[model samples]
Target: MSNEDVDSRRRRFLTITTGLGVVGTGFAVAPFALSMAPSERAKAIGAPVEVDISKIKPGAMRTEEWRGKPVWILNRTPDMLKTLPQMDKRLVDPKSEVDTQQPAYATNETRSIKPEILVLVGLCTHLNCSPLAKLKRGGSEGMEGDWLGGFFCPCHGSKFDLAGRVFKNVPAPTNMVVPPHTYLSDSRILIGVDKNKKSKKSKAKA
Candidate 1:
């Protein structure tokens, strides 16, 4: 080939190769850039978690994650509710006196906003082990008799009553933590925030 023709072909090849390199780099970096960007779910880590409690059957429980921690929402039966007062004498903080463990709105006998719905962080206070739900009264769960439905930590033999009350003489120091929560509706609850803020917002709008 002539020199001029050869030079023109070389230029064309260089331009094509450069365009291919740019395209290849863009394809390689696209996934990396996406991985670095914060996802919608990640941004909601510290934000409120809303749950629908309507389908949660009585005496059953539902669990969700908030701030990378497991949070439980238990529907207490009338019988389960009665067991709280009975276990008070055996609980370390029966009345939830330790304010830091839960929000002030949940510092009641049931440790909940509603009388029947109990919300608590599922982690044990002693070592952060997740407790297993043992919701059977006087049933075969290692505890012989008078075993009101509650949670049992297999990790270190810690026990929590149905109301999340730490039994006396247990390894756990206090009751399970109650995350700040509020009832958006009869069957919907928002965790990680209290109802006071919602009420305040409503007042401001009025």
Candidate 2:
């Protein structure tokens, strides 16, 4: 054969070999690359969320998704605060003694760092269903007269007070979970993390 023809054949062989090597390397490394990358479930479970509460009006509620769960932020009014104590006798765990449900800083009557601002998991303790806001005094949509602005799960008639405390005789055994949270500022809060003065305890307990 001619030298030129031999050189052309050699070049073609090198090109084909290089392409096969690249393809083989990609197949060998693909599994490791996927393993190193975070799964969707892992990302959903540990992501932290920051929320702005500056524009949340009194008695209004805002919900944000974190770790694939709904975190509710309620701006309580004077009227809502007044009703909390009155419903204590009717609640199951009025004092919030269930230590597993909230951080130490949030183990208060309002289940929050600030009484005026409530942070709670929107899911009902009975079932994982999110509750509907019945934030109005008196009965609405089959709730009784004593319903003084809280959450109600229509799925099973489970009721939670303004502070997410379960009421007596309700299907829910405990109050709504108060997720680990800390105030970033007067008008902002971080969910899924407690970086406050008591963060160590909060992290341990939560």
Candidate 3:
């Protein structure tokens, strides 16, 4: 082949290869960029949720899902707090008898760090269904009126008061469950393992 012809062919080949190289680089870089960014599941799993309990107001309950279960963080008003103690007679386990229903630290009135802030798992003891937040006092829902506030499950119509106590005559045999947790600061709650319990478990495993 002639030198000029051969030289022309080489130049054309180099140009095509350069273009293909750039295209391949663009494809590879796009995927790498995606890898560097956080996925939605990753963000949800480990993300620290910030909730402003300040605006929950009086007699109002706010519910958010954490770790696949409904985590209700309620701000009980003065009236609601006053009403909590009076509903015992109407409950199936007025004394919070079902010990496993709540964390050890949350066995008191309101079931929380502060009397005003209540946190609980909203599932009913019957068939693992979620309960509805009842903001009123009475109506033979099986709970007392002085009832103040709480949750009612529609699946089996199981009822739980502000303290996670199960009302009498409900399908749920026990009180609503409270997950293992602790207050991170004043308002932040980490709801999975109890720090103390986890240490004990790890020691036993080791």
The local distance difference test score of each candidate is: 0.81, 0.80, 0.68
Ranking by TM-score: 1, 2, 3
Every model's Cα RMSD, please? 13.0, 13.4, 14.2
Best by lDDT: 1
Question: For residues 141-190, could you state the per-residue lDDT of candidate 1 as single tens digits?
Answer: 77748888899888998899998889888899989898888888998898
True-structure lDDT of candidate 2 = 0.80
The RMSD (Cα, Å) of candidate 1 is: 13.0
The TM-score measured for candidate 2 stands at: 0.75
For candidate 3, the lDDT comes to 0.68
Model 1 misplaced stretches (Cα beyond 4 Å): 1-42, 197-206
As for candidate 2, its clashing pairs are: none
Q: Give the TM-score of candidate 1.
A: 0.75
